[model samples]
Structures are given as C-alpha cells and as structure tokens.
Target: MSALTETDPTGAGFSPEGLARIAPWMDRLVDEGRLAGLSVTVARRGRVAFARACGQADLARATPFTLDTVTRIYSMTKPLTSVAVMQLYEQGLFQLDDPVSRVLPEFAEMRVAVGGNRAKLETEPARRAITVRDLLTHTAGLTYGFMEATLVDAQYREHGVDYLAREGTLAEMTARVAKLPLLAQPGSAWNYSVATDVLGQFVAALSGRPFADYLREAVIGPLGMIDTDFFVRPELMPRFCATYAYDRARQLRLFDDSVETAFAKPPAIASGGGGLVSTAADYQRFCRMILNRGTLDGTRLLGRKTVELMLSNHLPGDLAAMGTPRFAETSYTGIGFGLGFSVMLDPARAQILGTPGEVAWGGLASTAFWIDPAEDLSVVLMTQLVPSSALPIRRELRVLTYAALAD
Candidate 1:
C-alpha cells in the first residue's frame, strides 16, 4: 500500500537494496494469495532500518494496505501484558513464586480437570497454588478457550468467557475464568492459555487500578505509545485493517467483525492474553525498551535485573506439557520460557540464526517480531491474516532479515 521501497534517505543500517532483496519474496506471497497485506519493519541499534507496506490490506477485496493500517495482534499482547506485571514486580509487590491465590482469593481453591474432559472435572486441591511466575511463564495449568476436540471446548463455549471479545475488564474476566477447572497443576507443565490475562487481573488488583489504566500509567504512557489501546478511537478506526482468513481453497475470505466478539471492546475485559491493537512504530518503541534493558531513551521502565528475569528461561523438563515436543536442540537450545516472553536458552534450538539470549514472540495475525540482543537487531513482520503461526514463511523472513545484515 505504501512503498518507500526506495533506499533509505537516512541510511540507518538498511539500504533500499536490502528491501529490494525481499521484494520478490513478498511479491510471491501476494501472487500466491498467501497473505492479504504485510507491514514489515526492521530496526538495528534502536533505529528504524526499514519499514514498508505491500499488497492490499484485504487480499480478497483488493483494499490496499498502508502504513497506518491496524490489524488484530492476537497473542502478541502477551509480551505487553507481561511487561505490565513486571512493573509490579519491580515494586516488590509480589515475588515470582508467590501463590496467585494470595493476591486473588478466587484462585485459592482452584481445581484441575482430572479426566481430560471438561465435564469430567474433579475437584482436587493442587499440590501448590499457581504462582505469579506460573502465570507469566504459562506454566500455571491454564488452557486456551479451545484445547481438545472434546468437552474442554464445550465448556469454554458455554462459559461465554470470550477471550477475543472486548467486553469485560481483566478482573471481571478473571473472576469468570477462576470458576473453570485448570488443565494441569501449577508449575508442572506449559500450556498456551489465558494465564497472562489472569496476570493482568493480578496487576489491577495489586495496583488498585484498571488493567489498561495501570498499563498506560506504568508503561504505555511512559513510553509514549499513544496509538495503542484496547479500542481504536473513532478517528483512528479508519486505519484498522479488515481481518481475513485463508481458506482451504487458498483464497482469502473477509471475516466480519462481531460486536459480541472481544475485538469490539468489551465491557471491562482487557484481555492481557490477546486484546491489543498496535502499529509497527508503536511496538518498536517497546522492543527498543527491551533492547535497552528496561529503559528507553532516558527513562527506565524496570531495573536491569528485572528485564533479565523476563528474558531468561524458566521451564523445567515438561516440554510436552508446554506443547513443544517436536522442538529440537538446535531450535530450542538453551531456549526456555521466562516471565512473559520466550527466552532463547539455546540459540541453536531456536533454529533461527539469532544471538544467544535473544527474546521474542509473535501475534496470531502472522505478526512475528524478535529482539536479538546478540545482534542488536529487532524485527517485526505484521499482516492481517489469522493463525500466522505457520513456520516456513516466517522462517524465510527471519532468514532473509539476518542475511541482509551488514555484519
């Protein structure tokens, strides 16, 4: 939609030639109907190296994508939610291993779904309470709204606890979620779940402020991320890109937004798990803070130690529970889960050619971004497609980004 495909006037590590190298790959994706639109940005040493928009925001509609386009970032909200909790962590309000129930009474008597079926939920006192750290690392036995092909999905649907819906505040949603059975015991395994949302609730309860309010005061406002929020403003709504899904026929389908859905702005439910809408520039400021070790420009968001804690791995030997059984040593090497982001425990295990101790994550909209401390590189690739978890295209982009490095 917006092509500065020409060389950078600033020549900040990225040349126009670097962008041209990826043009064919991006063009190929457009031609093959693989993506509706893409907004790509690469930064090195805290400066924007390259930023570009290509193709239509909706491949099916031919609506051209632009720099201001907004796409649902889905799970990309995790890192931000994680940061919010860490702000509390810096205050010494709670320790990483503190039992979650200590702060939120509802989680005190939590139970697990013993029979693997939501209907078979049997009450059993967990050997240990889910800890604040557990929520951040996703090891708190929480489960996504959709887990198995069985009763778990049914239970989620019946509860009306729409995670993607923008209805209730984080606390309200947490109260509803607490009534459900946990999928596993705390600290025993990894599960991609609503734990971070719960963490957001914890943030509100501890801070005595709404989650969004706390985030804005503690992080967003401090960092100057003015464009990000749970709900897009009336004026900014025009920049919101149309959402699309790739069908079996490899065609893009325009998906209608549902008011009842979480994306429409809930009553108070600010899902720390997946309720954020961000721009490349907005998120780059965040990555820059991480790259700067808890500070950006001259302001400090967290201490250096706190930032390290977030980027370090906290996983035990429960890869299967974490849903990473297929991960090999090369890609997962020294890689582990930290408070809110993926810690690169083993650079080789990460499969991508990144620095050791690099931390990164992506959104479900095919938005993948990583902050590589070793290389002093942070890259973000944003698009409007759902379920962007597929590897080849993302992997190719990562490789290409690395290849473009001047070294």
Candidate 2:
C-alpha cells in the first residue's frame, strides 16, 4: 500500500501547503465516522502533485485503505462505455443522430406512457425513434427500477427490469425493456435512466463482440488500466474495499464485505450504466487521457474534435431544468449534460467553486473524478458509501482542490 505523500517536484503549479490540507480534511471525515476509508489523488500538467490514503478499508478486519484499493466505481463506468460507443462512431459505423432502432430493432415499437397510474396505464405512440444521441444525452425515455417515485419507474421495478439473471444477457435484458412503456417521449426531457445500459447492447451489436470484451481490448487495455474491470480477479481480492451504509443512528455499518462482494464474479449482464470496479490510479489514467485531449502516453483513443464535442453542452434551452430531481447529486442551475459527462456552464450559477467547461461524474459509493482542461487539472476521490446522496463530499473536495492551485 502506497502511503500518503507529496510526489510533485518544485514546478508542478500546486502549493505544498495548500495540497497538505486535503489529507487532513479526509482524516477529519474518517475521524467523524462519516467514511470508513478513502483515497485521493490530484494531478496537473500531466504530473501527480498529491496522493494520500486514510481510514480502514475493512473496519471489522482493520484493513488499511491504500492508493491501490479497488472500489466499485458504479456510474463512472458510463463515461468509459460512452467512449467505446464513440470509437465505433469514429469508424463510421453509425452517426450520433442515427436511430437506435436501426441497430437494435427491439426498440422499434417502443411506446410512451401518456397519463396513468401504476394500476392502469395509458399509452401513445412515440414522437420518433430514439437516437444514439438521445441515449448519450439521457433524453431517451428509459428509467431505472431503483428510481421508484414515478409510475413508469414503479413499473420498472414491478417487471424486474434491472434483474441481472444468471442466464440472461444484455440482448435479452434490452428485449425485456422494449416491452415496457417509456417514461417520456424521446428527446423530450432529461431523465437519468438505463440509457447507458441500452447503449452497451448497441455497442455489442455494432462491434461484433461482447461489450466487456470490446471495453477491455479497446479502452482499458490501451489506457493500461490494469485494475479496472467489470469484476475483481481472485488474485486482487485482498486489496478490494468493503462497502458501508449509515445505520439508523447515522453510524457507519457494514453493508457489503469485499470477500463476499457481488463483484467477486462477473454478472450475466454487463451494466455499462453502473457496473465497474476500479482503483484511484487506474481511473486517473482514464482522466488524464481526457485532460490530454484524447491521448495518453501516445495512445489516442479518440480524436481531438470528437472529445471537444463530448465536453461541450448538448442540452437545449432549460433542458437541464429537468435534471434537478430529488435524487440528483449535482447543482442543475449552471450545469448541463454533455455526451457522457456533466458540463459546468457557469460556476456562479451553480453556487460552487469551479471553472466553466469542466466535465465530471461520480459513482454511487461516493467515488468521483473531474477533468478541467482550462486548468490542466484532474482529481480522483475514492470511497465506499451507499446512497451517495448521504453527503456533499464531492462539492467539498472540489472547493479544497481548486483552492490549492498555485497558478
């Protein structure tokens, strides 16, 4: 395990004193029992300036967390899945505006719920076929079963839309989803749903290989993200971190043990939406690729213009207004959804300390990463906590990180 230490040289554009505040803040969180274990890393101009680890990876076993601790990065997998799809796009296999039905015909006859209760549902024809861009921007009408506030969301749970059956596959799961009514019309509004999972199926169909295989061969292999994958290998199990949730008394308690984790083996469906385990160092390589304009150590996964299009705002006027639901972890006032990330449009409107054009995303377990091209900066925060909305740690980390910039 790598100890918390400053790795920057004299000219790295980060104040050592300012960078020093980061570990202490994390220590405070662990001291307060808000987090079981955590690790953080910051880099600028392609060089690491700060790296640290704190708390116990397994409080019950007294295992110390380290920089190489593997964690379930959940939705952070979306960005990587998006990159894979775009790689096929670069091959001229399909256009962004192309209808998803063109590739996955199962979605051809999809319907929208007009106005109905969970007991009785009404339906209407979709305005148009859902496009690849709609899935990328989350304008598609798909809904996650876990988001159970709405009637459609409730229907998803009732129908077992998210069940990762031992014998089921992405193609079969998508086919099941097609039989359900959509939560909204295509391109009508922004809803965080199973759109990315659907994109995974589309990728498999277009690339002539399984989604995970293509992801490993095309993205993870080239980036040298040795520890990032859909499942943790047996040899690396000792370094995997356990997950936690706050008890009724708001105390940290064991939720999932690393030894018996679901990620111990691969699932039937490769959930490109929220199914990945990664390390701080491994994810940093992915972020650095984005920060370096689609290239890392001479390995180019995407073209410069393609990356620019991805980082730019894709939402229309006030479409981001639809993103501020009760469960949203981000401030929607000045943020917009891009191809595969959240783009900061105006930091002032967001009421947070950040630069415009910055792109970022977080996992369900409090893990997060951001790339600021303007500042040539990248930061990765790793931890294991269920119901990520439990704290504003991501915002807190942002303030601490930007405050330490020497330039």
Candidate 3:
C-alpha cells in the first residue's frame, strides 16, 4: 500500500498529504478489478511532485507496473502530430487555411454524402475544399469507421479507412479515405475522423521524409522522448504493458497481450490519430514542452505565439453545441476543441474542478494527459483499457490533482 514519491525538483508548493491520496485511489481501482495497472505523474511549476505505479503491467506474468512501462497512448498521438504540423507551420511550409489538396493531390477531388444509407448513398460536390485547419480541429468532412451510426462512417469501414488496420502505407490508406464520401462539408461540423492521420501525411509531404522519420528527427528526438515511437523496439518489448477490455460480466478480459501486439512491429500506417507507445516519463517531457511554451531543455519546437494559437478555441460561435456524437465518454457541454486538444471554456459549465484554458486529451486505452498553463501544471495518467469511457477515472484524477495543490 506504499506509494513512491519524488522530491519536488522546483519546490513548487504541493501538499504531501494531498498528493498521498492518489496511489491509494488508483490502487483501489486495480484491487476492484477495474484496472489491470496504472501509473500517475503530476508536476507543478516544472517540478515533479508525484510519480507512482500500481498493480501489474502484465497480470498473467505477474509483472509489476513501473515508471518505464510503455503503453499504447492511442489517440493521445493527435497532440504530438499536431505539434509536428505546427513545426512545419513555423517554417512557413503551409498555412492553416490552405487547402489540403495543395500538398496531397488525392484530396483534390472530394465528394460529400448527400443522402441514403451506406447501401445507397448519394453524393455531391463539396461546398469547399478541406483545409489544413479542418484537419487539425476535426472539422473536416471526414469520419471514422467505428462511428457506424452514420452512412459515411459505414462507407469508411467498407473502404477500409481504418487507422489500426495495418494493411497499407499511410498514403494508400488516405487515398482509400479520399475515395469515400465526406460526412459533412468543410468547417461545417465536427466529426472525429482520420484528419490527423491526413495531417501526418501532410507533415511528411512538407518535411520531405517519411512521417515517422520526420516525427523522430524533428520532434521526438529534439524533445528527448526516447521511449516514444510508432512501434516498440525488440529489447523494449518486456516493458510494454498488456491492454484489457471489460467483459460481459464487467470483469477484466485480455484485449491485447504485451508479447503479441501489432505495436511490437513496424506498422504499415503510422496512425497520427491513434498510434504510438510511450512511457509516462517520455510523455511527461512532451507535456512539459507544451507547458513551457514550446521549449524544453533548450530545445525549441514551436514559437510562443504559435502555441498560444493552438491553445485557443477555434470553433465558431458555440460550434461545440452542434451536437456531435460523443465518440468517447467526453462531455462537450462547456468544452471547445482547439487545434489538437480540448480546451475548457468555463469551469462551471464543465461541472468539473478545472481552470479555464486548461487543455487535455486521452487515448483509446484510457491513458490521458492535461496541460494547465494558467497554473503551470501538467498531469499524466497511464493505463491500458479499451473504450476509455469504461470508467470516469480521468475526471476523478482531475479532481484529485487540483485538490492537491497547496499553493
């Protein structure tokens, strides 16, 4: 029942007793069979205040979850991909409003679904071309195949426009996506689509290298995210954790074994929307960079103004109220989608303990991280569970974290 604590590097005020509550709460979830394992890291004013891991990394093997245990961060990869695109943006490579067709000719001719279901769909010319901004904000006329309720979503599935399919290269998969009809017109509605994956291809096109290679050489390498990548290396496979999903009985069931996961090998497509394995420490560095206004350890990835623009809400006049279906457990009531993460507009409307302008995002496996520039704080929680909505753990973690601030 003992939890590990790290000496506060910056000596930013934090109550030891308040921080003490985290591990026990996390342990309770593991003991209750809600989580196979979990790791939490909290920092304030650039100081490491709390770092702890509980339960097993691989329950079948009885492996203990450690700080170094790498886990699939899934959709959390969006923010990182956004940063890469912004790096190119900083270099005058492309403007946010530029038509995506300028770089990826595949999107030059796109269509929008007019009516009918997946069985008999009707199409018409797009009102306007999809832009780079649409890709960053999920306002593009794209849709994910898992959103089967929509006819365009069904088309996405039928055409194999999957982020995790591991079948063809990103260019090929995106071409397949282009062949499908868009769910909405550009800048009209929000659909959590493969827009970021398209952004990754855009990055590669702009950087003159493979998306993975540019990400490594430009962002990951410069930021010192040594353990973050599209695939885990052979020697590091032992540190990879198993993923789980709840069964019909509401008990833990193996989803993906650590020893036998697609992440252990190079993926055919580097999914910018939901692909990447990283440790808590590695992700913390990435968060720290964002909180520090795009610089960490003398490495500058973005300009201060660019980071400010990324954190601001770009949706027009309460577009968050456009009633987009909640693909995950997120409540968009008082939330706004920024370039890469969700920005809290009003604390009361969100009905959660948070500050305005706080930005955060999570993964399909339940891993999440948030950066609070107002308080100079960043919190990261890592665990492996499918359908991240299974538990309200992220909200709970936020409450526990904000209440622990002593300053």
> Against the hidden reference, what TM-scores do the models get?
0.89, 0.97, 0.96
| C-alpha RMSD of candidate 2 | 1.8
Model 1 residue 229 CA deviation (Å) reads 0.6
Specify the poorest-scoring 10-residue window by lDDT in model 1.
1-10
lDDT of 1 by residue, 1-407 (tens): 02223235245565456555776888778778777778777777655667777888654345677766766776778898888888888888989888988899999888777674444555567788888888988888777665544354456667876766645556667888888877678877766778888888888899999887888788877887766787776666656777667677767776644222334453357778887887777787888888888987788998898887788778874243355432211134455777777766644655566666777777766787788877777877778776654335677877777777764
lDDT tens digits by residue: candidate 3, 105-134: 999888899897657999999989999999
* Whole-model Cα lDDT of every candidate shown, in order: 0.72, 0.88, 0.87
Which residue pairs in candidate 3 collide? Answer: none
**lDDT for predicted candidate 1 compared with the true structure:** 0.72
Give the residue spans of candidate 1 off by over 4 A. Answer: 1-19, 59-62, 116-119, 149-153, 166-169, 257-267, 317-334
| Predicted structure 1, TM vs. truth | 0.89
Relative to the unseen true structure, what is the C-alpha lDDT of residue 302 in candidate 2, on a scale of 0 to 100?
99
| Candidate 3 stretches greater than 4 Å from native | 1-5, 8-10, 317-319
C-alpha lDDT (0 to 100) for residue 282 of candidate 1: 77
